[model samples]
Target: MRQKARDLFEKLGYRKIMMAGMLLTGIILYGFLLDSVQSDTYDIQLFQLSQETIRSEKTVEDPVKTELERQRLTEEVAPSYQFMSEIVDNQTALVASIFGYILEVKAPPEQEEDRLTKEEMIEKLREDLRLLETSDNGLRLTDDMLSSLLSLSEARLLNVQKELNNLLESSLNESIRVEEVARYRTEIEQEIRRNETIPNDIIQAAVTIGRFGIIANEVVNEELTAKQVEQIRNSVEPTRILQGQVLVQEGQVIDREVYRQLELAGMTEERLNYKPLLGLFIFVIIAVGLLFIVISRSKKDDEHKITEMLVVMVATSISLILMKLLSAISNNFDLVISFFFPTALAGMLVCLLVNERAAVYVTIFVSAAAGLMLPSGYSATLQVDVAFYILFGGLTAIYLIDRVGGRGRLLHISLAVAFANALFVAFYLLLGQTQYSWSEIAFYFSAAVVSGLLSGALAIGFLPFFESAFGMLSTMRLIELSNPNHPLLKKILMETPGTYHHSLMVANLADASCEAIGANGLLARVGCYYHDIGKTKYPQFFIENQVNIENPHDRLPPEKSRDIILAHGIQGAQMLKKHKMPKEIIDVAAQHHGTSLLKFFYYKAKETNPDVDENTYRYEGPKPQTKEIAIISIADSLEAAVRSMKEPTSEKIKKLVDSIVEDKLKDGQFEECDISLKELKKVKEVMCDTLNGIFHSRIEYPKETN
Candidate 1:
């Protein structure tokens, strides 16, 4: 029944199968993405007191509260200050110079005629002091003040100038800002009054002049102050509402804070948003389109192309559906179960059933789909971390399984996958700075490990089904079929020993030749094993099976003999189909001889009857349509031809193999297949090498030994 169904699928052809796979993939993906896209929003007016209080549906960070707390902390930090000692030094020097000038003018000079009058000296001093008033120092001593200092006797003037300079220097020594200059001036005034050596009027005038010299030396450091505020803001921990935390009771009225929390938790209804669904549709289209383009451009046969499309679609769909199911369960229990989704299962299956490149492409598409389907904290869009997690896990599985030899290596691959999952989970937790307790960390780590092991286990479980359903000639299946214990192989060995030996020789030649030309050597060898199974039904009719008997064809007419010989191809294909073998191997049995004429039988008929039809001796064939089948055809013929050589020297064997391949080429047997001339030449050379090794000269043993 299964064989009949497989045959029916083969008859449906590639285009229909590919379309069905595409439609099924789109449906599965769209259903999951639609569920994710529907945001759960509450229908409540902004700022309006609610009749019924709304609690958070899921745990989320209160962005509004977190921001407010950070802002308040930042405002509480004090502005930083920097001291500028240079301003104090410049102002004090100006005061000392003004006082010294006054004393110098009051003193008697050796050249009395050159000395200026008091008023003239005062005018000159006013000019020098004019520039000081306009300076940043803010020093503006009046002309009257200068005249008052000059009017005093020279000794009293020096004493008053010394007193004023001492007061200004002491006041300017401390760090004073622009706002505190008045207080420093007041302190200096009291100090000057304490000095009774000069008159009270001199002390008052001196105090006023010293006050003008004082300026703010300390300034606000804007850059440093901003940095300090930023640090304070960052130090304040973010206030998060834990998952499943209730914001308000059912009967409690909705306040401003409760309303904001509902919005943050995505409980505020604003109608169902379909934008995510639309985006997901576009995403699916692009992913499917890319796969289509790659498959169309590749050199695979129609069956293989169909198989590839089916595997890709089915694997991606299964992975995403699993993610969605896990997400739904996690949402119910408030668990972060997205990490435990076996995202790498699809990638491992793809790598096993298809090529590595296709597996990589499938991994990327599956990761992106997972990001959308998985529950991200409060956002409806794709989660970047989930995407990274899936990508890391999937690629790791691909890399590990790519080097695997068979199903036996899957356990090791699973272990490697677990390590990769754990590493990525640790990295993600560390990057997000998530504070998980030892128990929580262990739970997450264990989940990740389970995800990896489950991915491998699921892949192993599904592999055989896919290989059987899609008729995929996977390496594992090929290896299984190549075993001698297979029923058909056992039958061939028991019933037709000569044909069995011939099939083995053909398998060896085909395997070596296919490998040399970069074809599927295993498929070729396995196909060759069952290529002549039809001979077992009529053991004595074929030459290989007629070991001690006369030629069966000599007793029958040439036309009847040709019919018996040509029936093997079709009969062998039917027998394989009965056993439900892969389509590729069955194709080898059906199309190995192609439509090439049986020249010996045709010539024998022509000699007996002058007008024998040539088509009667030709085998019915669709021709070899793949490189593997084409190489098998050539290898099968060459093996039989080389075995029949009476004098099987290296030179004779080489010549026979070359002649057979050339004759098949002339008959256009390889025209329909994709075997290039260069590959064919390599195949010929490999065959000659293998044949030479088998038929190489051996040393003669000494007669005396008998």
Candidate 2:
């Protein structure tokens, strides 16, 4: 059944399969967001009697009441005051200086000049006081008050100035409004009256002058007042509805606040509120569109493109479904289990199966989907916070797991992800200014820790299913196949030890070349290990497995020898298929030799017969179809040629490796693959370096001492 499905998928092609997968993902997400159990705004009416008792499913603060209380608290805060003592001092100085100037003009030095008449002097005093009044000094004095001050004699005026300065100094000590200035002036007059040393006339003059100078020095501090109001608002606690608390009882009339709460809880009615669902649909469209664009732009073969899209879509769907399931659990059990959802599972799996950049996109999509799947009572911004939590957890997992080479490293990655999860949760709590108790903090922290660990656990658990179902060549899977204890590897080790050693050398050479050319070294190495498995069937016939015996090919005809040599590629591929190895490994076994002619056998057969079919001496070849396989082919031939060298030198190794690669290039052995000339050059350089190291001249040990 699976094979039939795979054939159908192949026929449909990658684009069609991608479209189908996206469509299915959208349907599943839509179903999860708008489940049958959820209510819509159109289902319930305003001011209606409740038919059923409604209770708070989760502990949530009523934003409306909370805001109202905050506003009330802010309004109740008093305006702030700022003291300006300099105003009092400056005004007193101006009053004293004005009086002193008047006294000086009235009594000039006795013999200095001709004395002015009383009317002229009074006019001059009025003019001078007018100048003082109209000047930039902030004083509000009447002309009559200035005249009253000018009428006083020097002793009385001095007494009045002294009394007024003292009054103004004490009165303008604190912040006073414009309305309170008159009150302080009256208080100053009372203080003057309480002192009998000054006459009533002088006292009246002092009070009038002091009143004019006592301007409203203390004013409202706008900035400080605003800050105080904001602080008060912040201090107001949010009104909360505890879980399972009754909102409206059966037969109870729903008020405006109750109706709002019902709407917030998504319990109002079943009428379509297409806004959220529409938003979700648009989100899915954008996400899937971006994913499609990214996948389309990626450089991969048709089969790989199909497999990658399938894995991404399936992994994303599983993540969203998990979020929905956890959301449902949270709602049904009245628990905040969404925080514990293994949000990073899909992203980690994607990273393992695909690349990190694709995994990053998957993380973004899954995070947004998880946000949409949160409880309806959550505000839009809180939902965004939930998205952030999932994103951080998933990204942390991907970064920590990207370099992971074996399954044993998953535990360390899981612990790191858990730490990241906990850190994000702590940051969220701090950013939100949530007032959680120690126990509550511990609970959430533990949930985050569990979420991280479970993400890794779930990723590890689901990886095999994706790899097997999609035939993905993951590093972990390759590492497992590279193990020498595997059945096929063990068979080759015991049956044909020479061939095993040759395979090991080929694996090392292929791995190095692949790495040098930025290809899949692990896949190349593993493929090399199994590439020559067919040699095990007729170990003695193969030159490597002769074990010091006479050459078996010497007794056979050149045509039979060519057949035996060509059969290994096909037989090895068949044997790999029988054992259910990945197709990539099987291709290496089959196509490594390509269609290159067997020069030795073809030339040998032509020596005896005038007409020999050259095609019969060629390999049954599909050619190397990928960079890894192409490198394997070169590495396999290069290793065999170099190993057979007598007293191989660095220059000889380099020449031989270059010659073999150039021949393959000229013969079109690499034509079907994407290996470039630049990569080929790099492969040759790496081969020469590796072969030189392997077959380097060793110093002769001191045999005489032994």
Candidate 3:
């Protein structure tokens, strides 16, 4: 049952379930912002006293007032008109057609011998006028007017036509509008009536025909007037309610403009609004995408960091919960408490334990999350200033923390973060419109400084627990363990000086190779210091510690020598585990040798016995499972191999390092670890250079001492 639980625990590492919890955690994180993002609801109606100060959350145009302005401007514009000269021509043509038909009946131009009688003439005129009325030329003359024109002597008829033409021409001089059409027609009737030269029947006939020909000279241009009204509409700018504009101050009555602005800004929206939920989903998706990109870039690393990544979620949650709590407290008490939020805390932790890339991702997420909260001043919730401040400050901490040496560096990191935070706040002040007194300004900068300092202090306090809980080692911890005076190092040195010196040489080789391949060099160096601790128990038997003494291994059987040599891996692991060392370091000690063959012992045993089991000559092993340990394994073997050489040169060192790495490749030693061929190639190059430096030829020195 215990083994089963261990299997289950190891199964849940970060890279094992990267996608499984990302969306769920992201959604949970989004839930924390829903209430903060939602616009505040109010009990006060129009004309009521305000319970608190309320500001607009966004800018919006006033549609009703805008429409009213457009209507008033449209009325003030003068109507347009166009001179339709075609109307005058059409009316004049109709009058001419009427008189021409009357002349044809009264006296035919042919003057036939059987001349038509007056009754015949009148009847003929009427028939022709009826035909004319049905055609395009409109006939306007009445029956009385037609009969009178037929009865007129030839002289009187000519005079009446001349008088009507003059009167029609005079009326057109003014280019009559529709309103003047009636008066013009009446004046035409009076002109004929005043003529005593014409008979009463003629006057009546002229007046009837004149009224029919009268029409308005000009018409309204609908298209032009419409375009003018549109221009007026466009010219009127809309009245807007700007974001963060104070809608109603505390205890002020909700007047017309105030209430209208509140409604426009959505502060008066219904209680169960979906906008907040929609916004939360979008923001959560963005945060999830950021983390997904970060972890997805290194699949091998993420698989092992599962439980450690969950701790990342815990760190993020603390930041989110604290920011929300502080924002609420600040809102309630009218204090700028958000200035005291240690926004960089999560970023520092992620950069230290995981990586800078993942820390940067957390920085962006936290920055955005900080903005989507009930802001400090009862103003806009999603403050751009707040988001940018946290963003730059957190990123600053992440990069700086990468160079941290030990706990002593925490103070410098704190000062740097505090200065960064204060600088950002000052930047916001220069650009923002809000007025702040020097005392308030001092308070704000002080809070920001405290915020920065708190980030460093909290990270130090939380780091140990994270390291222990995750079974991981931080760089600071590695540095502390690497000290020459460490109890473990001193014990190994005094008990077995040869083994200690060999351990230090292996540490130098492994650290350089690990760094060349972007692995943990500090951990590799520290792991090397403890890798051979088991050699202390049987110091004289090991060749390194045997010094000039007689070889104990020469008398022992091949199997016994092999057994004693293999015991160190197991014993060193047990010793480190007893001391509660990091699992990573314990793994380096336990798995560095990795089931390799003891060829000399195996061959000697084979010569003595015909059929000996070769398995007994091999170390019982679990192979290196990480890049750092895998590098150390190669360094350990290569360091020992080169140290045993009679005369090492640069070419010989390179050749031997390549040979060992190639043998490890063929022996499948790197199969269990995630080290790639490319990285392994780089590791060999760095090791060869380090080995050449250690074994380089020197010039012969004179006997100056004598």
Candidate 4:
């Protein structure tokens, strides 16, 4: 049954599987995030004119209106207060501390050699007050408050403290709420003036100190306030509409009270809200439709890489999940925290692992979904600014990752992204009509920088996981394989030193040519390094590795020699597959020769017997199945053919490269791949330039005259 199922899956083809995948993606999106992306379906809102009259189905408590009434009652109830005797005591101590400081400044100790200056005393007193701010006394005195108190005579300062203490005892015996502190302060000033024994010189200063010391000691009693609220909520009966109540007449405006009644009676147009459900359907269609078009039009090579589709689908799902999580966080903060989302992570992953061009379109689909995950509930209107910001940032990431060369250049890419993200955020914030506070502007700016850095960090972090799980070949993986120390690369260098240098030359040629025609140059370069791995097993048999030895093939029949040459291509493929190398590298190794006639051995065989067949002297090949391999095939032959030339010149090399390309074209080696004639022309030009440079002649030193 399992084998049958696997066979059926293949028979259904990529198009059908893609359709099913798209459908599943849509369903998952709708199932999880429908509330965020659904539209304003019913068109019902407060204060709108009703086009049709709505009647109550049955009489019930109008919860909306009743709740409003209860809230009004709760608001009207004055907050109860509790006067604390301990607050009065603390204030008395703090006031006493101020007078003590004043008396100490008035008369320093006789035993001290140096008397403290008034300025120093005042400074000390000020520092003491600041320290007191942290204590239970919670006293905070200003410079004016401290200096004025210290300026008074020691005797007068003591009298002022006594007066303040008595006044607090008399006044705070009653309640003093924050709102009525002013009224009580005025009464205390009158009481102080009536005391004739107190000197008049410090009266104004004492009044200032008295007023400064006073605070609202009677704090609100939360227990009493909550009890009062509960009573109001319980006492207020729910408002009700009659069974036959006309909640709204035709063309009647939905005022607050009338709208509440209509809503309570389930007569609002949203009672049967189907538009959100329908909107979800349309939303899914648009998102999935974009993916379908993008994947369908990609390189023909992608049709076989079904894993690429699955990887992209999973990446898309991850992006949606990130948006949903960000929405949840944003709702809590009531801020658009999506500004900090790592929008470029998915784009960078797809660009490196899959097609860079397709990554841009996939990102657009993700960004469109991002706009749907808005702050507003369920009536999702796409936030044009957010969508635009995400789309541009994602596109920038794809461009940088695709075009930029070295790992060291990544920091430069991150900095570039940071600048773009910050600029985009600032531009949008400034351009919008709503006046955002400087703090809000700072928040968004910081989030943008963080967003850019996070994209790089997250892309780096998740790259290894995705590559391991999917066994996908990325540019980084290709670079790693290109290292000289890799076991397979070292094997060729040790066992087949001549073939190793030949492979390196082919790599240089293939890299330049593939890049000229907008193909994956890195893949071609790395593939070329391992393309001749089988020659390691029979290093001495091939001409390039025949150092200081007689040609072994000279001792064998032409038929036997052809078989040895033919076995190398097949053996290299098996060896690479055994080492678990990427399929793309294996393809290049297996198809670089492309079943072309082996003229050297075939002509030699033809001299011996007229009946010798041409088919017997060819490499068994699947042909070049991609542009990279096709270019490699051409470069492989061109490098060998040019190296064998005697006293090669630039003009001779160009003609030679052109002839090699035409020979491959005539033999139909490129028929299985998608390489075009125009691209081939560019490839020929690149090969000619590279070959000429490699074989350029230099002026010889004047023959050792000594």
Candidate 5:
């Protein structure tokens, strides 16, 4: 029954987990908030009633403005007169501002013309310079003497000529006049002289050129003034625009006022009011049913549906309860605050335990639940405002956080949550003209901490419950157990050092293999670490993992040797169960060896006793059921088998890993599971790489040093 439940959970989707969390969170948060709200309401109501009673006693003795005071009290409770409703609505409006339709800017006409003309001028100058430089170089100006002489200014050139004349007079016995050669040299010098004729048009044009232009048009909302709209338009405009060009399209918010637009999008007090209980119930049903569909619809197997639903629902419920406890505690304290509490908490979890896409939907569910569970002026109006905060907070958290592995980085995660919530609340307050103080900022910072801590706390507290209730073991718990400091792991290291070292090597190989195949690398690595833990019972039975071995297995009969080898899987599974390890780990340890033949033991038995049955030498059966387990099983064998090679080369390691994988495949070891052939090939490649690393050459110990 437990195995069945686990299998179902393994197949459950993000939606189911989220729905369960939402429902649980809603129930707890709602129960608590409703109680708190009711308690406060009762106090306020009792106070008002007491005042009325006092006035009645006064009126019975003598008449005054007692009736007027009663009327005033009634007015205070009126729906339109309630101040909190407006605050919540305004908050919603501010949150709505975070979303706006983006208009991509097109190229402006003036910028385009300017850019083209500049390019044309640069091209022309480049061509002209190339021709003059090329001609000057071809006239033997490559020589340093001639090149240096040509580089001088016109006056400097004449000084050089005078110097050359003096040199010729000093060196010669008689006067020499080569007029043609001198004339040619003079003409060449004039050609090489700088031309100052070109205008500074290029620099002028480059400086004057404008890149683009835009005309923003506020189309959807009219609450903003024409001047405000013009400001938005001007802000969006590209620096240069062609004459009569419409830079902005009609009915567009040229400069976006997100808060006002969000208000216009029905986040106002009038639009928020609804039958609170009915709205909450209906929304929950739609959300739950939709979530169920996303998670369960993809599967066609009838045998698994009931079990899957139960596990998913149970896992989700535990998560939700944790979220509620954290939220309730945070809300109760003046030190705790966040605009979107449960939503952010759920976002990080969805990323850790599930995929990002699932986290998104889960966040939505939590947001809606939060709306139903927060305090409001009019119960109906309050729900809507709360929903906005919840949705925006959840979506924003997930959107901002894209990757998952920063789980232990609490401070960093808290800062992220704080900034998000601050922006959310600040935007609302500023746009809605909501009042705030330094205390509010402090509250927001506290809320961010609460949000991040809640996520971590929930994962830690609920992990065990979910593992038990749903039989769904997670990667997190596996990693915790794989640590060398763990009691079981430490025992293995101290008592069975060879096995422990072997396990670590196998873990590295399996981890890399699983990642290459797009499987859970951590799960693979951790599973590998514990896959042979059964050998700890009789440490000297296995060769590589044995220390001071006197060939215990060799001394035993072939049949006995096979039995001992096969018994390790069962032994490992029993040990894990006794230690209360998660079922996933137990499966990895028990099933990793599968029912493959113990070739050495079987052949030895056959040689000694011709009538011996090969079946008696086989392992108890249950093949790899997932990619992580499958990769670990292969890694365990490959790591052991690779060490047998005397001079292991890259090519030999590749063949060895491939042969092991092919043998496993041919024997149908992966038939019952979802391990794909492509993944298997990747695993083979990783094993080869790891083997090379392990066997890489290092300096041998020197006898002199010893």
Candidate 6:
């Protein structure tokens, strides 16, 4: 039982081990919620009026008349006429009986007593004149006589008046009398009126009739007479009407029916399912175990095991708790809130003390809890939208963040959040039916801006907690220490100025080397600042603080000298841990030497005591895990090695950098932590470039030479 407990304890104690499981569970849970939310759909209803307002409803009480009687009424009422109804088709039908008529210019036959057709009068007169000519009865009818003779009826009376008026104004005696022309016109008009005919009302009845019948096969002719055209136009215009408007009356049952239909459509049955929840929980546990296995094998050197594991758990718990609490408050209060609560806080804390992967894991878990807790709304599926926003925003924050030990770095993280939120909201608006009211638009903008500000603020608030609990030295802390005004740094400066200057130079070289190889330059520089902190224990033993005194190693045996020299790495790690520095900084202090040989002490000890083991003189190490640590190891060697040159030249600097890297590679100092040969080559180049800068030749001044 004790052994099992110890094994479990070991599992949780490793920082990387816990993160492996936490992140996988978080993402899987988020995906589950996303799928579940889609099951529920909302109900909706739209209303409009019924279609029955166009056609006329006629009654049997209205009598139908014979064709003869209709024609008599038509002629007696107003004269020459045409009748029609309105238009209709498949989409709209006539609702009521309405009709209209078009009248010609002249009055009807009964009312017009003086009109005649030209052919009628011409035929009658033609016969009379032919008979008279054949009989040789030369009768001279004078204009006055013809005018009096034309006055037979009201039509003839008008003809006689025209002749009298025209004859008086003419110059020639044989000029045609106006009475004859008038009489001819009156005869033609009467004949035309008397011969007036009516056609079938097939075309008129079809107008505005919809759905009840098919459209007629015949197309109306383009050359239709003016009367025919007028009839068709009047037929259609007044016949059709729309029935889409609502009319509420005391007896109408439609209101109640519409209400019932709307309620039925509005019902929705979307709720949480338990099987998925339990399945996700199981997945989380399994994932945790797998992650433990991957990272456990990676931790070859088991130093500060308890401390590393505790850091992972505490950070994870605090970040998760804060996220959950904030999500709930944001929902309850109806306030704008980020899906990723305190993003920068989570990101900076994870990056500073733990690996970047661990930080990413923390982000994923926080986003998962948000998916479960976000509130629902008519226009929103908060579960999915929030989870995606948090997931993507956190990912962007992690990708862009740099540990430059400046507030400006937070701005870049904020910019990334803004860009990610804009993209997500734009996609949702364009693709989905999620309505964007003014309030919703304002809410989105406020959420994005507040997310940025809150991330920065929370990072500031939570940083000290992680720092104090883990005994971690963040880049920020190291930067503060490197300042000359720092109390400890000032003491080192006033008491032992040489060590202070040496540390500064090492910081520069390490920073440059790390940057060249695409490693964390800020971390490298900061680590260098604190790497030799163990020397403060026995300041005189270190070469930098020795002042002008005799070497401490000169009086000691090789074994003792080797022990003192190698113990500093362990001592530095212990001091940092005691002062509550982060394990990453502690790691740099412990692993920078990487168990490399102490050549002078080892050779001297072999000469003095031939039976002595060479391993006893070596530095203890879990070889550098990250590129920053690897570069720091190289910089430590380069700085010390190059300083020994009295008159350093560019070629010497290059050879020193090359030889140091090659020897470390051959010694297998970089065998662990996944450092590649390509990285070593890069480290060499960086060291060479930095060394060249430090030892560049300067021209002599003429005054100085004199």
Per-residue alpha-carbon lDDT of model 2 for 1-706, expressed as tens digits? 4578679877997778778877876776567655522332334467888887777654667888899999888878888877777897788888887787679767855775668665666667666667666765434444555555567788887877787777777887766787787787788778878877666655555665666777778678999999998888888888887755677888888888888887666666655656666766776678778887777866677667777888888898788677767775775754366788886888888888877778999998888777767653433323677788889988988887756657767878888888888898889779865478887788889989899889878887898898888878776678779888799999999988988999999999999999886678888999999999998878888888887799989999998998888899999999999999998899999999998889999999999996998888889899899999999889889888987889999989888988999899888999899989999889888888888888889999876763
Candidate 4 residues 127-172, lDDT tens each? 6666666654355565666666777777777777898888877787
Decreasing TM-score order of the candidates: 3, 1, 2, 4, 5, 6
Q: For model 5, how does the per-residue alpha-carbon lDDT over 454-476 read when each residue is reduced to its tens digit?
A: 55555556556656664554545
For every candidate in turn, the CA RMSD to the true structure comes to 7.6, 10.0, 4.8, 25.3, 32.5, 18.4
Per-residue lDDT of model 1, residues 98-181, tens digit only: 777777766677896988987798887877777776776556566677777777887777677677777777777788987998
Using TM-score as the measure, the top candidate is 3
Q: Model 5: how far is 387 from its true place, Å?
A: 5.0
Least well predicted 10-residue stretch by lDDT in candidate 2: 35-44
Error of 3 at 543 (Å): 4.3
Candidate 1: worst 10 consecutive residues by lDDT?
Answer: 51-60
The Cα RMSD of model 5 versus the native structure comes to 32.5
- Segments of candidate 3 deviating more than 4 angstroms: 1-6, 9-16, 45-49, 97-176, 179-214, 227-239, 248-265, 299-302, 333-336, 374-381, 490-497, 538-564, 598-617, 662-668, 676-678, 700-706
Candidate 4, superposed: residue stretches over 4 Å from native: 1-10, 25-33, 38-286, 301-311, 374-379, 403-419, 422-450, 461-472, 516-518, 547-550, 555-560, 603-616, 665-668, 676-682, 696-706
User: How close to the true structure is residue 165 of candidate 3, measured as C-alpha lDDT?
Assistant: 71
Candidate 1 stretches greater than 4 Å from native: 1-297, 332-345, 360-472, 578-580
| Evaluation by lDDT, superior candidate among 3 and 5 | 3
Give candidate 5 misplaced runs (Cα > 4 Å).
1-286, 293-343, 348-356, 376-432, 440-444, 546-550, 692-706
How close is every model to the real structure, measured as TM-score? 0.70, 0.67, 0.83, 0.60, 0.55, 0.52
Identify the superior model by TM-score, candidate 3 or candidate 4: 3
Cα-based RMSD of candidate 4: 25.3
Per-residue lDDT of 385-407 in model 6, one digit per residue for the tens? 66676677777777766545444
Two-way lDDT contest, 2 vs 5, winner: 2
Superposition error at 7 for model 5 (Å): 12
